[model samples]
Target: MDPGGRVNIFVDTFAWFTDPAHYTGSNAVQVRVFEHLELSALAVLIAAAIALPIGLYLGHTGRLAFIALNVANVGRALPSLALLAFALPIAFSLGLGLGFWPTLISLIPLALPPIMTNAYVGIRGVDRDVIEAARGMGLSEPGILRTVEAPLALPLILSGLRTASVNVVATATLGALVAGGGLGRYIVDGLALQEYDRLFAGALLVATLAILVEVAFGRFEARAVSPGLRSPADAL
Candidate 1:
């Protein structure tokens, strides 16, 4: 489009963002943003709860590497939209219907692979010297993992979380497909109405959220790493 058209979209987006109807009223942008946040958080938390332990254990032991392999394959093979469609039918059969639960179920898988892979890789990547030193210090396996390895692996773990969280947030836009009502409501409504202004607003909002999520995670990852991992200048 022309520069004028692009500028108009920006203007329209600003209007949508600032409008009281999209903020203070029922089913407004404010409400939708929270809905999106909640849905994304639930998916990420569930995935992390399950995937992190499995990945950490596998990474630490270097066993059942195939599990990560399989998960990666599944993640690669199925797009989130396809997963949501697949789950919708399955959920209906289970009497979960086509709404929040189905959307959550579908989106959880989208969050899993990165989390599991990162946890596994992070743990596995820890220095042999550190592992040996911890072992030599009479640290039990559990003790060593908790006290020595976990802190070191945290950066990568967070990196995985960062990736997963961003992906989940972006994908939650698909929730609108299932009537799951998120920030995506605007997009769907905009498309159905052929309202390019609302379309641009919704797209901008999601993109902004994804970028913010990434930046926040990046900051947390840097700050969260063990001091030992930092260079002298950084630590100082």
Candidate 2:
């Protein structure tokens, strides 16, 4: 398309967003935004559930620390697209089809590294003197980990979750590659039909969603964190 045509198409697409016709159906941008957030939320929840406990245990025990570190590094090093492609066949063979399961599985890896690394690093970064002080107070190991270590590590842990959430939300756009749905629907369909208008719209929505997620989390982190731990910038 010519520059003028592309510009016109972009304007037209932005205009479409304000039209009720574009948002009243199941496939509307409004609906797709919900679907996209649902997938991203599920992926983040699953990754956090799987990664956090192991990371905390390893960090606290000082055993199998290498394994926890390696798991995070491996997750970081893996390619998200390649991971999706590789899982597709196995998921298909298992009758999972080309939909939610396969796509979410791909996003898990994209999310795991940050959560795992942050959990481990956060816990380990807890001062040993503090741990000793807790122990001296007759705190059990579990008590120390729960009350002393975890609280102190909360900031880094949150930072990790934020990173994973952002990555998963952004990469969730790739769901369209395997017949899955999300905000990526617009981008995929636009590209197939040479609709630069809808393509730019989808890109805009995805970027906006990511920024919103970051801001929401930043606010939550600020509130959830203890006043003593709040940095100057994070202080309300």
Per-prediction TM-score, please? Answer: 0.94, 0.93
Candidate 2 to native Cα RMSD, angstroms: 2.1
Q: Candidate 1: worst 10 consecutive residues by lDDT? A: 67-76
Model 1 misplaced stretches (Cα beyond 4 Å): none
> Per-residue lDDT of 63-117 in model 1, one digit per residue for the tens?
9898665966597569888899888988898998766889999988888889998
Give the number of colliding residue pairs in candidate 1: 0
* Local distance difference test, candidate 2: 0.89
Per-residue lDDT for 211 in model 1? 94
Total clashing pairs for each candidate: 0, 0
TM-score of 2: 0.93
**Candidate 2 residue lDDT tens string, 23-128:** 8777798888998999999999999999899888888988888866886788789888898997798788889999688999899988888998898989999999
- Model 1 TM-score is 0.94
Model 2 stretches astray by more than 4 angstroms: 1-6, 231-236
